[model samples]
Every structure is written in C-alpha cells, then in structure tokens.
Target chain A: MPSYKLIYFDLPGLAEPIRLLFSYGKVPFIDQRITKEEWVTLKPTTPFGHLPILEIDGVPYSHSRAIFRYVGSIVGLIGKDPMENLAIDSVLGAMLDIREAIVKLRFCEDEAKKPELKKALEERYQRTYKKLEVDAGKNGGYLALNRPTWTDVLFCYNYELLRNALGIDVLTPYPNLQKVKKTVLSQEGIREYLKKRAPNPMKPKYELQQDL
Target chain B: MPSYKLIYFDLPGLAEPIRLLFSYGKVPFIDQRITKEEWVTLKPTTPFGHLPILEIDGVPYSHSRAIFRYVGSIVGLIGKDPMENLAIDSVLGAMLDIREAIVKLRFCEDEAKKPELKKALEERYQRTYKKLEVDAGKNGGYLALNRPTWTDVLFCYNYELLRNALGIDVLTPYPNLQKVKKTVLSQEGIREYLKKRAPNPMKPKYELQQDL
Candidate 1:
C-alpha cells in the first residue's frame, strides 16, 4: 500500500472526513496539520492551492470532494459498483447544496443582512435535510445502500459545521440522520480516534470529540 | 438495462453534459425538455425541485453533477477502477472550480462592478486553463488520461458555457484543450447528436451546432 499523508489545518474543517475514513478503515497515515501562517507558504505547492490535500506517496490530490471520494473508495466506504456509487455520490452532491447555502452565509460581512441570509440558509438546510432523512430512513439509518458509506461521514461532518455555523439544532427533526450519527460513531476505529482527538478551537460548540 | 429519461429545460444548460454523454455512449434516452411554464408544475414532484433530472425506470434522481456521473458511467466514460476514477473525478472537480468562478461573474447583475468581475474571471480562467493544459499535455491531449473519459466531456461542455457566457474565446490560447474538444466532438455518436440538436436560445452566441 502507498503511504498516505493528509495535510490540513488543525481544525477538522475539510480534512476530518478523510482522517475519519482512515481511522474507520484502520489505515495508517500521517495526519499533518499546519498553522495559517504555514498554510500561506505551502498553499502554492498544492495542485489547486487549497487545503485538505491528500498526498499518496508524495503525489498530492486537491479538491476536497474528489479527495473524499478517493479516500472513501480506498477505505471501502464507497459503493461496490457504479450504480451504488451514484446513490452515494448523489446524496453527497445534494448535501453540497446545503453546504453551499451555509458557505454563502459565512461570507456575509454586513450584520444587518445576516438575518436574511440565515433564513435562506435555514430553508435550504431543512429541505435538503428532509430529503436525506427520507433516504436515510430507506437505508435503515445509513445514508446510502443500507450500509455505512462515505456519505455518512460527509453528512455527519457537514452536519456539525452547518449546525454550529447556523446556530440551530437542525437535526432534531430528523431521526434517521441522528441514527446515522450513531452508526458512524459506533465504529470502533472512529470511536478510538475521536476519544483521542483534540478539541476544535474554531468550533468549540461541537466537534467530533463531542460524539465520543 | 433500465430506460433512461432526462428531464430538463428546453435550453441545454445543466442538462447538456448528460445529453452529450448519452450521445458519446450511443444510448437512447427520452430527451424530455419542458418549458419554464411546465417546470412550475413539475418542480414540486422533483426530488430537489430542480431540473436536469435522470429518471431511471421512472425513479427520479436530481442534482446535475450526480446525474452526469451516473449517465457517464452507463456510457463507459467513467474509469474502470477506483484510482482511475479518482483522476477523472479530480479533473472534473478542478474544472468545477473554474466553472464556479465563471458562473459567479455571470450572475453579477451590477454593471458598475462588471469590469472587476470580468478581470477576476479572466485571471481565474487563464490560471485554471493553464493547469488543465499541463494535464492535457501529460495525458496525450485528454484531460484525465491519454484516452477519452468523462473528464473530457465535462471540460468541453464547461468550456463552451463559460466561453459564450463570458463572451470570450478562452480555448484559443490552449492547444491541448482544443485537441480535447476535437477528440470529444469527433466521436461518431456525439457528432451525430450535435448535428441533430437544436440551437440553444439562452446562449445565442454559441451552440454545439457551431462545432458541427
């Protein structure tokens, strides 16, 4: 197997799912986190000048979603075939719609205009979450194919980010997704990793550590 | 095999790549183009209330990128293994970064800020195009691999959309991508589909018919 090294900030932000996948599969890797100052110097070295890069045997692959899918595949979190992957990838893509909404709101500088952005974010989040809820229910608490796929990892990570960022308990209404969180956290590898993982300074409100 | 039906607007927009892939694969699909008036009634029934949906045996799957990947797989544009798919998917994802920049500028309705957005768009386009040029050169004129894949399909489609939308001929500077476009367009299936396809009203400046 090729040596895997993940480069990102100390915070979970984008790299967490990759790390979580490594742990979930018991794959050994170097989880290298750089400071913001270090990121400036290293950014140019990346293929697309972005963080959350996965370097395999010194070959770097950027684009978080692409990296997630790649890592998810290696860790066996991806589906067995194209059709199965489409189901997983489609759910992953749909969650991006929700993530995009939160990201749009994150860029708002005007304090007075935040309410409108938040409301729009809430509406989008709820609608997308409701769709995922139905899928999760169909899959028996898993996000896709009635098993734990990378979609579950992505969903849980994005859930906290979107929830804490939006300052709302959005998942309270969705029982199936909550079950997804439980299913993911129940993994032995993930549980051990989370217990030892450091608390996130950026999102002190909720981190993977909280699940442990 | 399941019967494939693509539902989208009368315009190409997000649905073009799906159509192009089907053409490339030589698969027959019901190209269901509904007008804006019809979309309202159809919207409520869609999974995410969006167009560019692929209904397989009447089971609807929305989200354009997800649909593209699913359709791409059926057409044999997807990679045979996880690693190869990663390369194809990463290239597609990188192209999306460029596509997003162009789309953002396109949606800027402020005439006063148009120049700034245009400049930023050009810079982004040039930088990303240069990177893709390098990849194309390495992969023997194909974006992801030496031979044609779904990455080529996505790049060519996004290239035209970004080009006509920005009113700029971005491909003239990159020989490799030009080769990529030619390779995709030269496929007998894609060529025949383009010839028979109607002109896009939204982008009156350019259409697939122009290449044909």
Candidate 2:
C-alpha cells in the first residue's frame, strides 16, 4: 500500500470524506491537520493553494472530487463498472453541489442578500434531499448501488455542514437519508474512526461524535 | 454500440460537450434540442427537472458530469488507471469550477457586484488556464493527457462560453490552451459537427464554428 498523508485545516470541510474512506478501508494514513497561520506559509508551495491535498506516497494531488474518486477506487467503494460509477458520481456531484451552496451561504458578506440566499439554499437542499430520499429508499438506505459508496460518506459529512449552516437539522424531513446515515455510521471501521476522531471547533453542534 | 439521445436546450450550454464527444468518437446520436415553451411541459418528466439528460437505450441519466464521464469512458477518453484518472478528473474538476464561476458572473443580479465578480472570474480563468497551459505544454497540446480526453473537448466548449461571457478571447494569453483548442478542432468528426451545429443565441459572439 502507498503511504498517504492528507493536508488540510482542522475542520471536516472537504477532507472528511477522504479521511472517512481511509478509515473504512482499514488503512493507516498520516492525518496532517494545519492551522490558518501554517497554511499562510504553506499556500505558496501548493500546486493550487487549496486544502485537502492528498499526498499519495509523497506526490500531492489536488481537488476533493479527484481525491475522493481516487481513494474510493482504492478502497473498493467507487464502482466496478462505468455505468455503476456513473450513478455513484452523479450522487457525489449532487452532494458537492449542496456543499458548495452551503459554503457560499456561510461566507456571504452581503447582509441584505443573506436571507434570500438562505431561502434559496434551503429549497435546493430540500429538493436534493428529496431526490436522495428516493434513491436511498430504493438502494436499501445507501446513497448508490444498493450498498455503501463514497457518496454515503460524502452525504453524511456534508449533512454536518448543511445542518450547521442552515441552522436546521437538515436530514430530519428525510427518514430515508437518516437511515442512510445510520447505515454509513454502522460500518465497523467508520464507527471506530468516529469514536476516536478529534472534536472540530468550527462545527461544534453537528459533530460526527454525536452520531457515534 | 449503445444508441444515444441527448436532451437539452438548443444552446450549447451543458449538452455541447456530450455532442462533441459523440462527434469525436464518430458515433451518431439524437440531439434533442428543446425551446423554453417545450421545456415547461417536459421538465416534469425529467429525473431532476434538469436538461442535458443522456438516454442510453431508453434509461435517462441525469447530471452533466456523470454523463460526461460515462460517455468519455465508453469512447476511450477516460484515463486507464486510478492515478491516470486522478489527473484527468483533476482537470475536469478545474474546468467545472471555472464554468460554475462564469455562470455566477453571468447571472449576477447585483449591479455593484458585477465588476468584482468579473475581475475575480478573470483571475480564476487565468490561474486555471495557466495550469492547463503547463499541462498541455507537457502533454503535447492536450489538456489532461498527451492524447485528447473529455477535458480537452470540455475545455474547448467552456472556452467558448467563458470567452463570450467575459467578452474577451481568454485563450490568447495561453498558447498551449490555444494549441489545445486547435487539437480539439482538428478532429474530423468534431469539425463536421461544428460546421453543422446551430449557433447559440445566448453566446452569439463566440461560436465553435469559428474554430472549424
């Protein structure tokens, strides 16, 4: 196995799904968390000055979607065939879309437009969650393929941020997605990782620890 | 070979890359372009009420990225291995990021924020284009690999919109991306498609036909 080191800020923002994947695969990796001060010094040396750069055996790779797919493929969580991977990727793309919207809402400097953005975000999240609910219902509570894929982990992590950013338990209305969360958390390695994971100061209310 | 039908607006928008892929592979596909009047009645039948749905055989697949990857894979445009795929996907993700930023800029309702958004988008495009330039320079004029991948086609289509939306020829600064555009344009099937493809009303200034 290649040595792995994930460089990111302490929060579970874009890097958590990757960490979750490693844990689920029962693989050992160096989880290198950085501070904002350290990142200021480190940013110039990065390929794109972005976080969640996964160093696979020392070479750094950027972008969470690429990194997630890479790690997911290694852990047998991606998909076996192109068609299957297509379905998996579609769900991942949707989850990322939601994550991006929530990020935008959180960082909106325009106080006047914040409410409008928030309402738009809430509606988007509801539509997305509703669709996922049907998929989860059909796939035995997994996000794709009638079993757990990286998207399940992605959904669970993004749920944390979406819940905090929206100031609502975003998954409450969708029982199927809630079940999907339960299925993901029930995995032995993920459960162990969740139990031992460090507390994130940024999103305190909706911690994975709470799920554990 | 699977029979393909792409459903989207008459404008290039999201469906053009899929069309380019089919054209590049020398495959025939039904290009179902709809107007806004028809879309209202058709939207309810769509899986996610979104366009650019790829119907393979008869099953409709939603989401552009998913559709792109699936079509790319079938046409031998996706990378062969996990690491190779990481490279391809990184470029694809970057292109998507740029496209999303441009979309936001185009739809900005706040007049005061328009220039700020425009400047930021220009900077992002430059950064992305510079990175792609180096990669294309290294890979003998292709965006992701030495040979053409879906990203090369995606880059070409996005360059059209990004150029038109920003009201500037963005590729002039980066010769390798210009070369990348030339490489995509030189494909015989793509040349034919570009020659016959309808001009987009939204981006009337820039068209792929100019490349042909």
Candidate 3:
C-alpha cells in the first residue's frame, strides 16, 4: 500500500476527518502540521498553493473534499451502491455549505457584526441539522447506508468540532446527530486514536487543549 | 439504468459539463433548464435551496462536483487507475480554485473595483494557466494520464468561460492550455455536443463557435 501523508494546519480545520478515517480504518499515515509562517513558504510548493494536501507515495493531491473522497474510498467509507453514495454526497455537500457560511463569517472584521453572522449561521445550522436528523432516523444509525461511510466520518468530525470547539450548542437541536457522535466515538480504534493523539483540537474554532 | 434529469440555469453555468458528459457517453437524459425568475420560485424545492440538480430516476442530486463525479464515472471520464484519478482531482481542484477566484471578482458590487478584481484575476488566471500548461505538457494532452477525462471537460468549459464571458486572455500566457482546448474539442462526440448546445456565452475566454 502507498503511504498517505496528510499535510495541514496545526488545528484540525480540514485534516481531522482524514485523520479520523485513518484511525477508524486502522490505516497508517503521517499527520504533518505546519505553522502559518511555514505555510507561507509551503503554499507555493503545493499544486494549487493550498493546504490539507494528501501525498500518496510521493505524489501530491490538493483540495480537501477531493482528498476526503479518495481517502473515504480507500477506507470503504464510500458505500457500495451509487444511491448510498448520493445520500452521502447530500449530507457532505450540505456540510460544505455550512463550512462556506463559516468562511464568509470568518472574514468579517467588525465585532458588532459577528452576532448577526452567528445568528445567521445558527439558523442555517439548525435547518441542516433537522434534515440530518430525519436522514439519520431513517438510516438506523449511519448517515446514508447502515454501514459507516466517509459521510459518517465527515459528519462525526463536524459535530465534534461544532460541539467541542465552537461551543455552539448546535447539535442539541438534532438528537440523531448527537447519537451518531456517540456511536463514532465509541469505536475501539477511534477511541484508542483519540487517546494516543490526546488534546488535538479538531476544529478551528477551538484553541489548543481547551476543548479537551 | 436509472433515468436522469439534470436541471439548472438556462445558461450553461455548472450544469454544462454533466450535459457534455451525457452527450459524449450517449447516455439518455432530460436536459432541463429554468429561467432566473423561475429559479426564484423553484430554488426553494431544491436541496440546500439551489439549482443544478440531477434527478436520478426522480431522486434529486445537488452540488455540482458530486454530480459531475457521478456522471464522470458513468461516462468513463474518471480514469481507470486510482493514481490517474488522483491526478485528475489535482487538475480539477486547481480549476475550481481559478473558478472561485473568478467568482470572487464576479461578486464585487462596486464597478470601480472591478478593474482591480479583474487585474488580480488575470494574474491568478495566468499563473493557473502556466501551471496547467506544464502539467498538460508533462502528461500528454490530458491532465490525468493520456486519455481525456472529466478534467478536460472542466478545463475546456472553464477555459471558454474565462476567455469569452470573463473577457480575459487566458491563452496568451499559457500556450499549452490552448493546445489542450484544441485536443478536447476534436473529440467526435464533444465536437457534436458543442455544436448542438448553442453558443455558450459561458464558453471559455478564447474559443470561437466553429472551434467547438
């Protein structure tokens, strides 16, 4: 098997899910984190001058979603069927939508404008969570198929990030989301990975050691 | 096989590549378009409240990239090898980066600011084109391996849109990009599809209708 080396920011911003997938699937990988200053030098070396890059063997691949999909496929997190994959896409894409909203808000300079942005995000988040709740309820435990696919890794990572780091109390609106989190965290390999990589902040919203 | 109906803006926008793939692969599909005002009314029904939805036997698939990948797989545009697919992802992801830069400039409301936005976009476009030129030269005509994949469709579409609609000279800085465009447009099915699809004002920055 080709060695997968994931490069990203120190925070779990985008690399966490891939890390979780590696751990969950019992795959070995190099989780390389660089400082912002180092990224300034590293960016130019990247294919698209971006981070969260996955290098298989020595070849590099950029784009978080694309990398996620590739990793998901390797770990059997992608479903066997197309429809199941589409269901995964729906939730994953919605999460991307949520991330885009967060990116938009992150660029806001005014402290006073933050509350409005937060409120807007909360509204969007609740609506997304409600849909996820319905989907999770329908699926038994997983997001799409009964099996835990990459969508689950992504969803679980997102939930953990939001709840642990963001302190948003967002998942409280969706019981199924909370349940999914518990289910993923309870996995033996993932539990051990967490213990081994203790105190790693899995979301950008959280500072080091605070969420842990 | 499931019947697929792709719905999007009346103009090409994000849905064209899927249409192109379906046409090239000779897959039967319902080509559905909605007017701007119609989109206002219809958007609410869409997942994430957006258009460019692919209804696979009445089940809706939103998010352009996911739909493109699904269709790419069906059409054999997604390479046969895993590494080739990863390379394709690199190219496509890079194309998306360029497209997003163009999108950022597009959202600028101040007309006076457009020139500055355009200038930044031009520099970025030239840089992206240069990188792609190198990749294309290194990997034969296609971005991934030697065969034309969805990366070609993505690049051709973006190249045309960047050249025509965006009114930027993408070719001047990167000669190899123009060559890749020439190679893709020569494909029998792709050539026919472009002819029948009407003049995509969305076509790349440099392509003429006859070239399609």
Rank by lDDT, highest first. Answer: 2, 1, 3
For candidate 3, the docking band is acceptable
Q: Given candidate 2, what's the lDDT at residue B47?
A: 65
- Write candidate 1's Cα lDDT for A14-116 as tens digits: 7888888888888999999899999999976777777788888998887788888888988888888777887888888778887887877898888898899
> Regarding lDDT, does 2 or 3 come out ahead?
2
Pairs that collide, model 1 = none
Alpha-carbon deviation at A159 in model 3, angstroms: 2.2
Task: For candidate 3, give the lDDT of residue A98.
Answer: 77
Which consecutive 10 residues in model 2 chain B have the weakest lDDT in total?
B197-206
Candidate with the larger TM-score of 1 and 2: 1
Q: Tens-digit lDDT track for model 1 on B1-212?
A: 89999999888778988899999989999999998889999987777767788899988887888888888888888888777887888887777877777777788888898788878777777777888899899999898877888979888888887778677677998998899998888889989998888777774687755776
Candidates' C-alpha lDDT: 0.83, 0.85, 0.75
What level of docking quality does candidate 1 show? Answer: medium
- Alpha carbon lDDT at A140, candidate 2: 85
Error of 1 at B69 (Å): 1.2
Candidate 3: list runs displaced more than 4 Å: A81-83, A111-116, A164-166, A198-212, B111-116, B198-210
